[model samples]
Target: MELTVDERWDLIDKISKQTITFGRYSHTLKDAIAEITVKPLTGIPIAIAVMYGFWSFFGAFAGFFTDGFFVKIFDEHWLPWLQKVFPGEGGFLYYILVGDPTADNCFEAFGMLTSGLFVAIGVVLPAIIAFYLFLIIMEDSGYLPRLAVLIDTILHKIGLHGFAIVPIVLSLGCNVPAVTATRTLETKKQRFMMATLLAIFIPCGAQLGMMIEIIPGYVGFVMLYLLIGFFVTGFVLNKIIPGRSPEILMDVPPYRMPTVRNIGRKMWMRVKGFLFVAIPFVMLGVLLVNVLYWWGVIDWLADILEPVLSAWFGVPKETVGPLLAAFLRKDLAIAQLSAIEMTTYQLITSVVLINLYFPCVATFAMILKEGKEGGCKSAPIFLLGSLATLVATVFLFGGLLHLIWIILGVA
Candidate 1:
């Protein structure tokens, strides 16, 4: 016989109140679920707080290695000798040897792909490892799901469900992984919208590390403003672009202490994955940049890129080198910026544009996968969205700096 509605209600209430003990705590599973799932604000804040803590720790840890080890030891001693051996002053071998075709000195090769080994090892490796460490912890903690619940209402207004939080948060670590994670979502519309946004605005770990180092103190404020612009633009796009918000229904895994071994393994796996892809690109990019310098291609390309690069972006013509390398590896882009001379305003604008522009190649593949899974057949929309955001961000940040410079009489 079927139970009456009143009987079901009574049973639920009883279950909710029933007590069970596990380890040092005791609570009914039903009641625990209610407390976590129903209180969106509480759970969300806890999740975000944990995430902030993790990243802050990572930043400090990575900065230690970059400054204490790589910068102090590698850049100070090893690079100088390598430059002497390669000696790129006269012959064709010198061009390949010194890492730069046009330069007699080693420092110039620091900007080219040859001496870029120092850049990759000194800056990118430590930072990427730290970022993945934080990312993996967040994943294991099961906090990301609760974050979705917390932001569900706001996300709904933006034409997305709470689950969209997964991709957006992951994009901070790297848009590639975030795009891949979009498969967890139930709807195609949700996936496409998220993929476009991730590719367009999310600064991956490598780009972020560059910003932390190269962006001057005051202009760091402007970087914050740029993030505001990212969110605002995304919100507006969510409305103008057609899509239905998916309903939120997700598992809130219990909070448990993640095993040390598990966290270490996960973090290492992510770092290794990135290195496997990044190392090849780093070598190829170095070779390409060095060859271009030897062939006069860099100067020619700089001349062509100068109109947009210097005039519109307010960055020096030299910045074109790093900007070209940005597609190959963002860390190199940031490192290249260090080789150029620019005012604080120009530096901020360039950094903002670099962070906002085209995602790395690995990220593109993940985005395409997300798009296909979501049943959004048109890939051009995601590509165009990313490119448009790039152009708009460059103009916006550059214009903001121009106004500031004029106001201060620094222009």
Candidate 2:
């Protein structure tokens, strides 16, 4: 006969009492490290150090590839070869494909075959590799959960659980998956808030890579500004949005050494995603921007937009093309932004606006797709919420930045 629950437990207890010897468990080195890393005073500094290492590695790896190696391959060898061999040197087809015959660097070339390929293959590819490599290592090592715990209190004030940092971190790589990741949030309010904040404020790895390529010195400033915007907007949304910001129980996993196979697999998948999703967009962005320029649409819009952009944003009219391209690919838009002549302040403002203005098409689609599935809010609420957040963030943050520059006499 099957024993009842109490009887079974009693029998198991008797058996354990008779047969099993209980030993005092010893705390291992991993346990000690975990304890140290999760505590507030220790963990925060460790987290900061880890992030600094991540940043240094990313910069060094991407710079070494883009500057040391690919710059030579693309700018010196590839551009000249294409400029010489491509037919109809000054014709529309030639201009669209090979860009400026006289331009020395791939960036200035602005062609599908030149800048598009170089930016996608050389610049962004390396950045994402470095980013994901380190991220995967951290993830596999089990430090991410401790990080989530450490950052939890700050995130709670913004209506997100500490684990919400996952999506934010992921958004650093790409927003499409980051938007999907919002589903991990327990509450509708949390998910919506996280998604909105990320799409508006977080630049993708490719975009960061391009920023590194174009404005490495100012990337830190831009990221800091965006971080401020993220928190500020999140605070407002938390206070105003009607919903429960509930506490979540975290399941922190044990620390383990990262294996090469797992790291390689995850990194390959991420880089592959970057390649397939990104390269086509880069090519398309170049093609479309060129077409718009060729058709006089850019010039037409520039005339209409110049007054508003110049007066309100302190950016130049030449930014119209990049702004248009930003919707297609923010990284490509920044690459294009770099080609335009502007002061450091204007470039900064323009790049920030480009990042804040809109989500790329893939990310937009993910928002629409992911919004329909979960929780208290319906799709309309989700979509409109994100759009509203984007609108307020872009104008408030964008206009405020311009005002700051003006105050500093930088504009």
Off by over 4 Å in 2: 1-22, 375-377
Judge candidate 2 at residue 92 and give its lDDT: 98
Cα lDDT tens digits, model 2, 1-411, are: 999999999999999899989789998998999999999988899999999999999999999999999999998899999999999988999989998889999998899999999989989899889899988998899988889999999998888889998898889989998999888788888888888889999999999999988888999999999999999999999999999989989999999999999999998898777778788988999999999998999999999998889988889998999999988899899999878889999999998999999899889988888788864459988999899889888888888999999999989
Off by over 4 Å in 1: 1-25, 28-52, 87-97, 100-108, 111-114, 216-223, 372-377, 381-401, 404-411
Give the alpha carbon lDDT tens digit for every residue of 1-411 in model 1: 888999999988788778643467568775575476448556666655665787577668778987788766655566565556655466666555455444433235653434566666667788788877766766776656767777788777667778788888778777887887777766656666667666766777777766666662543475467567666766777766676666767777776657799998887787787678777776667666666767888788888888877666667887777777777777777766766778877777677667667676677666655555445646666556556756765577566666666787866
RMSD (CA, angstroms), candidate 2: 2.8
- Mark the 10 consecutive residues where model 1 has the least summed lDDT: 98-107
Candidate 1's displacement at residue 41, Å, is: 6.3
Q: Give lDDT per model, in order.
A: 0.68, 0.91
The Cα error of candidate 1 at residue 279, in Å, is: 1.4
lDDT (Cα, 0-100) at 273 in candidate 1: 76
- TM of each candidate vs. truth: 0.82, 0.94
